[model samples]
Target: MPNAMTKTTSLAQRLLRYGLYAILLVMAFVYLMPLWVMLLTSLKDVEEIRTGTLLSLPGSLNFDAWGKAWGSACTGGTCEGISPYLMNSFMIVIPAVVISTLLGALNGYVIAMWRFRGSELFFGLLLIGCFIPFQVVLLPMARTLSFFGLANTTTGLVMVHVVYGVAFTTLFFRNFYIALPKELISAARLDGAGFFRIFWRIVLPLSTPIIVVTVIWQFTQIWNDFLFGVVFSGFDTQPVTVALNNLVNTSFGGKQYNVDMAAALIAAAPTLLVYVFAGKYFVRGLTAGAVKG
Candidate 1:
């Protein structure tokens, strides 16, 4: 009887594990359904798309839509496609990401490793910047940008992204640094290492995981930004997001769903690639950073 009971218990646990796996598979399919639809839609021409359901495979796979979307799609009166705006986004994102990450790292190191009065309060205030609604600052930011003659330029957009992104990056680095052993800093001081030397030689090398997280986060945030891009960018300096919007909203001969979907995929591709490649590091960094502080 005891032997029979053990067998039944093992069978039941196995069944439960299988059931959980099945549920997870279903949830993943649900999440991926939209992406599947978008790809399907983007492959079909306007005629086939009108006749077929969204989930149906294209009767004939068409690559012209992608080409058109990338090189000749209309945005208002301009038919120059998304290529230029894509370049503009890269320019803004790279500089903003690098500048913000560097500043955040310095700020985090000082706040975490050095002792000073009101430092905690200063960090707390910085955290508040992350929670505040960006909408609240648009007017003031615009005014300031105009005052500085940076309105509607790529430089202004980069500055805006860097300013907003720094708070989160600083928080990430600060938390990760807080978990580091204090003895390491003490030993470095004993070796007559100053702050910059200790940071460059000891701390920065150990910061690979958190640095990956900050770069990925900042890249995604700046790349996907539309509101600031729209408000701050000029006709010549608009980012991919704004261009994609213009392409979708422009009243052409007819609504080109395939072209719009293709444009969207192009706009989203870089960030998706970043997440796919560095997702493991992102998770590790978050876990490690949260372990202590």
Candidate 2:
């Protein structure tokens, strides 16, 4: 009787495990459906994409849409395609991420270690600045760019990113720095280390977690940014997001869903790849900076 009961309980546990596995498999399919559709649509010809059932395979597989999205698709009066926009976006985003992250690190170090008058209040104001909606400040920023003769240029877009991104980045760094050992800082100070010298040699090395978080956050923001690029970057400096938007908005007699999908995928590739690869590090950084002290 005891042996029979044990077998029954083991069998019941196995069934429960199987049920959970089934449910997870179904959930995975549900979430992946959109990406599956996009990939299939990209392979189909225009006519096939239009007439074929969404679940059905294309009549003929083709790479034309992919090529067109990357090199030949027309955008209104312009047809230079997604290539130039890709380069311009990288130019805008990379420098913005680099400069913002470095500045944030320096700000975090200064605020966490040094004694100054009303430093907390000043940082509190900066924190408030981050909460203001980007739309609220867009007009003022645009006007300022114009005043500086930087509007509608790559530099202008980067300037906007740096200005806004700093608040968030600084918060991350400041919080992370606060969690670090004050004795470490005090020792360095007693050794007559200047602020910049200590920051370069010691604090930065231990800030890997915050740095990864900052980079990932900034990359996603600047890469996928729409409003800033559209408002600040003219045709010559527009990133892929704006270019892709133009492609989406310029459909003619029939929509080129395949080409449009391909363009979106191309625009999204960098962020997607970064998150998939560096996601673990990003999460680790956030956990480490969670105010341990």
Candidate 3:
């Protein structure tokens, strides 16, 4: 009788597990449907895209649309394509991400390990930056950029992204550092290590997971930013996202959905690749940081 009951329980457990798996599969399909549609639309010619349903497969694989989008596409009078804009995005994102991450790490270390008078209050003010709406600062930032002679340049865009990105990165590192054992810091200090020394030797080595998470987050945020890019960047300095927008909205002949989709996909590829590669570390860092805090 006991053996029979155990067999029944095992069957129930398996059924429940399979049921959850089925639900997750459905959810995944639902989420991926849009991406599949975009890819299919990008591959199809204009005629097929206009006549066919969104979910329908392309009649034949064609690389022409992708090529046009990448190289020969026109945005208004400019026929330079997205290549230059893509380069501009990289130039902006790289510096912005590196500076923000470094500053965040330093700020987080100080806030988490070294307590000074009103430090918590200062940290609280910094945290407020994460919650404030970007719109509120847009005009002020533009004015500041003009004052600094950085208006309408890649450098200006990078500065804007770095300022906005630091808050989130700081939060990430602070929470992660807060969870670290205090004794490790104490021992380093006792051994005559200073703030920078301990950070360089001890904290950074153990920060791989959180650093990966921060980089991925910052990369995605800065790469995908359109508002700041549009406002701050000139034609030559424009990031890919702004360029994509211009390409899509350019009324050269008519709306070419295929070209627009291809451009978007190209623009989105880097952030998507970053997430796909570092997704494991991203999840691990979130979990560990939350648990430790």
Candidate 4:
């Protein structure tokens, strides 16, 4: 009787586990449904999209829509496609990420290691930037950019992103740096290693995890930004996000669903790829300093 009861309990536990797995599988499918639709739609022509179900498989792999989205689809009034705007995004994102990351690292280093008067107050003030809404700064930023003759330029957009990104990057680095051993900085100082030397040698090498976190964070934010890109960039400097919006909205002939889907996918591809490749690092970095701050 005891053996039979134990077997029954074990079977119940196994069934429960299977039930949990089934729920997880269902939730995952629901979450991924949109991506599934987009991929299918992008691969299908307009005819298939109109006649077939959203989940229907494409009759054949089609590259025409991808090609059009990349090089020939009209966005706004331009027929040059998203390629230029995509390049513009790259131009904006790379500089913005690098400048913001470096500046954040330096600022964090100072705040975490170098004590000075009003340092805490200064950090508090800096933190304010992280919470400020994008809308709140638009007018002021536009005016500032105009004053500096940077309005409607890729350079201006880069500057805007760097300024906006710096606060978060600084926060990440500061939290991470504060968790690091103070003894390392102290020993380096006692050894007569200067600020730059210690930073270049000891601090920076130890900063890899945080650096990855900051880079991924900033890259995703800056790359996907639509409002800033649309507002600050001129026709020639519009980022891929803006171009994708225009591509979808522009009414020329019949609506091209496949091209729109392909363009959307293209715009999203970079951030997706970044996450796919470096997602583990992002999570690891976040946890590295979790215990302290």
lDDT of 4 by residue, 176-287 (tens): 9999999999999999999999888998899999999999999999999999988889989999999999999997888889999999999999999999999999999989
Candidate 1 regions exceeding 4 Å error are none
Model 4: worst 10 consecutive residues (lDDT sum)? 284-293
* Runs with alpha carbons beyond 4 Å of true place in candidate 4: 1-13
Query: Candidate 3, residues 1-293: lDDT per residue as tens digits?
Result: 99999999999999999999999999999999988988999999999988999999999998788999999899766987798899999999999999999999999999999989998998999999999898999999999999999999888898999999898888889989999999999999999999999999999898888888899889988998889988888878989988898898897777888888888899999988887888888898788783355
* Cα TM-score per model: 0.98, 0.92, 0.96, 0.95
Better of 1 and 3 by lDDT: 1
Highest-scoring model, TM-score:
1
Which segments of candidate 2 are over 4 A away from where they belong? 1-23, 290-293
**Residue 187 deviation, candidate 3, in Å?**
1.7
User: How well is each residue in 1-293 modelled by candidate 1, as lDDT tens digits?
Assistant: 99999999999999999999999999999999999998988999999999889989998889888999999999877998898899999999999999999999999999999969999999999999899788988999999999999999999999999889899989989999999999999999999999999999999999998999999999998999999999889999999999999999997688889999999999999999999999999999888773358
Q: Write the per-residue lDDT of candidate 2 for residues 1-293, one digit (tens) a residue.
A: 99999999999999999999999999999998988888888888888876787878877779889999999887766887799999999999999999999998988888887759998997999889779898999989988999999989999899899999999888889999998889888899899998888898889999998899999999999999998988888878999999999999997678999999888888889999999999999899889983442
| List of clashing residue pairs for candidate 2 | none
* Prediction 2 TM-score vs. true: 0.92
lDDT of each: 0.93, 0.89, 0.90, 0.92
Of 2 and 4, the candidate ranking higher by TM-score: 4
